[model samples]
Target chain A: MRMDKEVVNPIIDTILGSITSGLNSLQASMEPYLPELSWVAYLAFAIYVLIILAGGFMSILCRNLVRAMMGLVLTFLGVAGMYLLLASPFLAFMQLLIYVGAVCVLIFFAIMLTRNVSDGEEAHWPTLGALGYGLLALLAPLGVIGPLIIMHAGKIPVQVPVENPTGELGEGLLSDYVLPFELISIILLVAMAGAVYLAFRGFGPEKSKRHSK
Target chain B: MTTLTFFLLASLLLLAIGLAGLITRRTLVGMLISVELMLNGAGLSIVAAYKSTAASDVLGQLATLFVMGLAAAEATLVLAMILVVHRRFGKVTTKEISLLR
Candidate 1:
């Protein structure tokens, strides 16, 4: 009778272990696959993406050079918005200050400086053939690579709320990333010097002769 | 799709558009703008990754800062070079500036 009891208990425990694992698997699979996005949040995301799409379209497909530059500005703004949504407000501000205020201005300066060549009748719209080819080129990689990524997209991790990324960013910048930051500064100086040298050299005697055509 | 995946896909689309533009654009300035689009896509992806995977970490944001700096430097030098190109070649199309040919 004791032997019979021991044997039956071992069998029962084995059955319970398997059942528990099966239930665990079921629970894991049922873990909320739906992201907690409301309709409003979804709409906001769609609008931001649309803004980026419009900007990209204008930048690439527009006939007018000025319009293309405006599109670039729009794209920058949309990216800044995206950064804000991603919880990096400082990055959003930096994107605005740097891309919109500085880079676009510099680009406009270059455009004006080379207006005779860059801003002329060559501003005509891209041909349908070109657009078709561009679209084909655009879709090829997405077709080949996108499916595999989707298959393995996996579950999204829980997001941690970060209160002050800026302060942390500053601390990390000064401590761990100080060297790279200094190097970037040096590179900026070099780029500035080089740009000035190139731009100010201008239509000099030797070069103007070559551009006479 | 979830928000994270949506952002990733959007960034990917931007990258694809940039690639297409780079391939089809014959003009120097247009190509530069396309490259800028690609850089923007990269930064967005980095920021998104930080948001989704490592929300507690600031390293991704730091990387993005460096990316921005590099992009700025690239744009400056390229625009300067474009200016010089216009001065030398009388045109800004890629077909004209192929010195190797």
Candidate 2:
């Protein structure tokens, strides 16, 4: 492994060097207009948007369920970056820990458990007719109407964003939103119990014995 | 476009994509994934709304926290239900499990 890494390291370094150099050249060329670290934020935002779009499209259109889950994971990560851009690092971390970490793993497990069930089912890719219908059904109307509304609507005046609201968020959760906070815990507990029960409801001793015969 | 506008538009797009997926997906798990996308869109829009309209208010962050909690719970329950359905019906696709019809 060490020898392989030694051989591959130079190639990886060369690729990375070229990419960074290319970006630097592009930034230098655009320096007069963009001029500073602001463009980096925009670049990051654009990358996140691309990830979201690609991941969402892949999740919807992919034939493989596991690949679809991976796409969903990408969407989660992109949304976490969006949260960071929105000045909420706490929620961004939660998005990473819960959505990408926990939820995606859970979905992966479900995919593994149910693999045989989906094998011979109507699990094919959407045909061109279905794709066209889906586009017409949702995308066309939303695409046409969404821009019209946004263009006509008066913009909400932007305020100076809070630099860090996580502390205030905690205080509010403890004081103003305490009830809902506690309720969420209870809901999670109930869900956990319910899920376990639902999954193993029929695996009683007698049923297991019957199946064994 | 302004950051606020960009987020709103992106969230709207996410919603439309999610809904389209929900309509077009053939598997129960795929539908669950679509619902998650819709929820993320809702969370982003909420945070963006609060960021632009009420920068100091912690309500938006709190609401998003609640959303994440609910999403975790929903994923748990839905995946479990999917397992049950697969066990009982021996299939996990939408078209194959129609017992009533």
Candidate 3:
């Protein structure tokens, strides 16, 4: 027992000692350079992530349709904040306008159209059974996949960006991305028309008759 | 330890939550909401990758913008379809709307 303790304990101590000293060195090296503003920024990012988590939970788990829509609004806003932190202010603005403004409005309108759609219990499924299945589906794959990706992530790719942030966005869109830009606009127009037609189709005289038949 | 990895991991967690929500929710709208969460997770991951590896390339943000645009279009059409289903069947739960199945 004494020999086992001496040999095994020393091995474990060396491993733990290396990890602690490595972490300490890293902390010592970084402490001098990290600015006070970084703390605020990190704090904001933390808040944004929390908002996103709460919003997602509220939207998914809420029993009321209106509350769910509200949660969705918060989630979009939180996503927009994350975009800002990513240094893509333009994308962040687009997120606000497109997701928070347009998509949530669409959901709200649908909920109003079908009042009492959320009348039943949160779900008809047996709650515990569904939770178990849902957790099993998500956790099982993540358990198998997470370690694989982490193992590969150690290749540690390094890329240095050559252009300015917003400038690159403007140039990229106008020059290399012009075709896709116009194509997306066309797609939007088509989708808008289709949505309008589909939404109003049953209210139309001939379409209503056809649908009924 | 980098902020980039933090957001990426958060996005993955959000995606997992969304999948769980999709499985648990019986309502069509609820499922759609879960899908939205998943899409947001994808967009966040892309942006995180962009911020970390290619800060100058606007492609990542552009991809996210495209995702938002697609989400807008998808939500519009899906909600419209939901409206139609409600009008037709007077029910919104997955169990009741299995006409094709």
lDDT of 1: 0.78
Expressed as tens digits, the lDDT of each residue in A1-213 for candidate 2 is: 356877899999999999878888887887654424354677887998999999999888777777788889889989998888877888899999989988888888878888822443436867788777777656764777578647844455655346565678788989989999999999999999999999888787777775676
Order by lDDT, highest first:
2, 1, 3
Tell how far residue A99 is off in model 3, in angstroms: 0.9
Q: Which digits, one per residue and each the tens of the lDDT, describe model 1 over residues B1-101? A: 44667778778878887888877776777777788888999999888877767454588888888888899899999899988898778777788889952
What TM-score does model 1 achieve against the real structure? Answer: 0.81
> Which interface RMSD values do the candidates have, in the order shown?
1.9, 2.8, 3.1
Docking class of 3: acceptable
Candidate 2: tens digits of C-alpha lDDT, residues B7-94: 7877877888888888788778888888899899899988877876655458888898899999999999999999989987887878
Please report, as a residue range, the 10-residue window in candidate 1 chain A with the lowest summed lDDT. A34-43
- lDDT of each candidate versus the true structure: 0.78, 0.81, 0.75
Best by DockQ: 2
Error of 1 at A27 (Å): 21
lDDT for model 2 comes to 0.81
lDDT of 3 by residue, A1-213 (tens): 356777899999999899878766765677644322244456788899899989988877787867877887888888888877766777788878887778778877777776735565343444788879988867864676566555555245433222246777778889988887887788888888888888788775687578666
DockQ of each: 0.43, 0.55, 0.45
**Comparing 1 and 2 by DockQ, which wins?**
2
Query: Cα deviation of B1 in candidate 3 (Å)?
Result: 4.0
TM-score of each: 0.81, 0.81, 0.80
